[model samples]
Target: MSSNAELHTLKQRTDNYAYVLRCRETGLCAVIDASEPDSVLELLARIDGRLSLILNTHHHPDHTAANPELVARTGAPVLAAPWSGHAGSGPDITLKDGDPIILGRLRGTVLATPGHTLSDLCFWFEADRLLFTGDTLFSMGCGRLFEGTARQMWASLTRLRALPADTLVLCGHDYTLGNIAFARSLDPHNAALLEWEATVRARKAVGALPPHPTLGLEARANPFLRADDPDIQKSLDMPGADPSDVFAEIRRRKDHFTA
Candidate 1:
């Protein structure tokens, strides 16, 4: 596998994101999360026009709404967890944790991360050192605990945090602004976070988002990832509390956050 695999990000709706992974040498391509089939098809044409696989991070309609349509148009095999109801008539290939999906010379390893949904999965391209975190882990926060419990979510995040520090994370939505707002309410004195908020706000003001933050940067700026941090724990008045318990409180406050 030549390390020339390139990623292209597509925004569907207001906050949703769809990504395309393409091999620069072979022109082989894989589409991740088909939010809108039309938009994906258009981008496919622009990027070599060869769709070999459709990878869904979760069964949410926002992510898989275009799955069936895309399969119908391109005849590409869809790969997703069996529990994801939005995989249309089910995936052509049922993906499991630690399994790899190959496209040309590129390979994406599947990781089961059930939090927002029981079937949530993230795709990790180890060769490229990139991770496509569906909704479980975002830029500065994580997904809401819709179907999974707070403890489950905590474990899920812990697993992600253990990945290589330099790994680049591509998440499901554009919630950095709202996440930063909530983070500031707790870890106010974090210089890295304050600087990140200023930079993200400026980008938003100009209608552009800052380049996706890496795992190392998120570890510093994202409060959810820092649920056990001294300042965050102190702010919540839970000094020496369990990380999971601390995470639950942070999640509770984030749910009621205005911005």
Candidate 2:
């Protein structure tokens, strides 16, 4: 993306993450998944940001709880998936797959990735190689099948796996450490997974957030994203099984995972 476009990642309500995207040239800003109204408003005030848009990835409260306050405060329009259950006056602009979203000079495309929720939408800024994947995709894990099927989630992940290898994945939550544990359980010998776990632990030890992994790194390390890998399939004793099936089994195990 342009050097003029800046992104601020805000930690919210425990593990949730919200983001502020600002366009320097226009001084226009957009908040993605404003989970905490107070925090987001405080940041906007500090930065003197003129909020022009509020973007939501899903209807979950953790992602939309601040919609009403934000919309009322800034008069900014809310852009979200058609099925979004906003706490405010619904979405001002309902987006679908392939839709275009413009923030000043930056352009983004909406990807309908329904798995975590039937309404999950991911924003991809091709120029900047920044992908804001709400709850659909996580660091080393994928979201649970709350309102969609395993097949849907697997297909959604497959589409994301095709993005530019360098794309920076900004997910909704920071589950890196826990996810690393799960990945190791399945792919214990994966050098990439082991290395990533070490890096994440080191960051945590120093009180730093885990570094956002590039799409390429995710493809290599995230077991959920590698459901199609022959090695993973073999490890699961499901060699040659459909990738979606493998993905479903993994998700099931994750849902019941302890530690």
Candidate 3:
């Protein structure tokens, strides 16, 4: 099915991102990761949309700090994972992996990706070819295992990797430049990575939002997703190592990576 959803991207709170999704058919709207109420409210007003649902990817303050205010302002019900520890208004309807999210004619699927936080849930609007990854998968990087194990993180990433190559990735944070730097350090000879780095630099120089990379580009360029690649394993001096172990090592390197 093709998408009947209109996506509006809003940059909020420094590096964080909040998305507004509107169903074109029924005019129903939903906000993903309502991080900043003022910005989200302004956009909603500009778009003349009545917020129907406030979707939370995780319980992190940067991702959900405005949940209560948004709910109060728009009377929109919150939808989140059962374990989501949202600050004020709790989830009106809890979601799980494979659960369907309906916004008018647009349908999305909830993907349980518990790497950044055990409660992390990504929304995949297959018809639209959009994946809203909340800190679980970045452009050229993945989230650090703050509350979960490396193995768990790897497993979560694997699930995302299985998505369609053309799917556009919308991440929670704009850490693309830093992630690119890290990716280049590992895969210096990757033409795709090099080309992407130039594109990102150009966009950043113009103060534009980082380009939203496709899953196919990520599979070829992102070292985190390429943990099973022989080149990545060899670069880490862990040839023939388990993919999980390779992912763990990459995550470890990224944690301390300054450049």
Global CA lDDT of candidate 3, please?
0.89
Candidate 1's TM-score: 0.94
State each model's CA lDDT, in order. Answer: 0.85, 0.90, 0.89
Better of 2 and 3 by lDDT: 2
Residue-level lDDT of model 1, residues 109-212, one tens digit each, is 89999889888899988788788998999988999998998888888888888888888889999888788888888877789888888888888789775667
> What pairs collide in candidate 2?
1-128
Candidates ranked, most accurate by lDDT first: 2, 3, 1
lDDT score, residue 20, model 1?
89
Worst 10 residues of 2 by lDDT: 81-90
Give candidate 2 regions above 4 Å deviation.
Answer: 84-88
- Candidate 3 regions exceeding 4 Å error are 1-3, 84-86
Residue 74 in model 1: lDDT: 89
- Please tell me which model should have the higher lDDT, number 1 or number 2: 2
lDDT of 3 by residue, 1-259 (tens): 2657788889998899999999877778999986789988898888778789899888788888888888888898989987534355468899899999988888899999997888789999998999999899999998878789888888998899999999999999999989999998898889999999999999989988888999999999999998899999999999999999999999999989999
Q: State the lDDT of candidate 2 residue by residue for 1-259, as single tens digits.
A: 5697788889999999999998888878999997788888898888878899999998888888898889889999999987633444568899999999899988999999999988899999998889999988899998999899999999999999999999999999998889988988988888888888888889899988888888998999898998899998988999999999999999999999888
Could you give the C-alpha RMSD of every candidate to the true structure, in order shown? 1.8, 1.4, 1.5
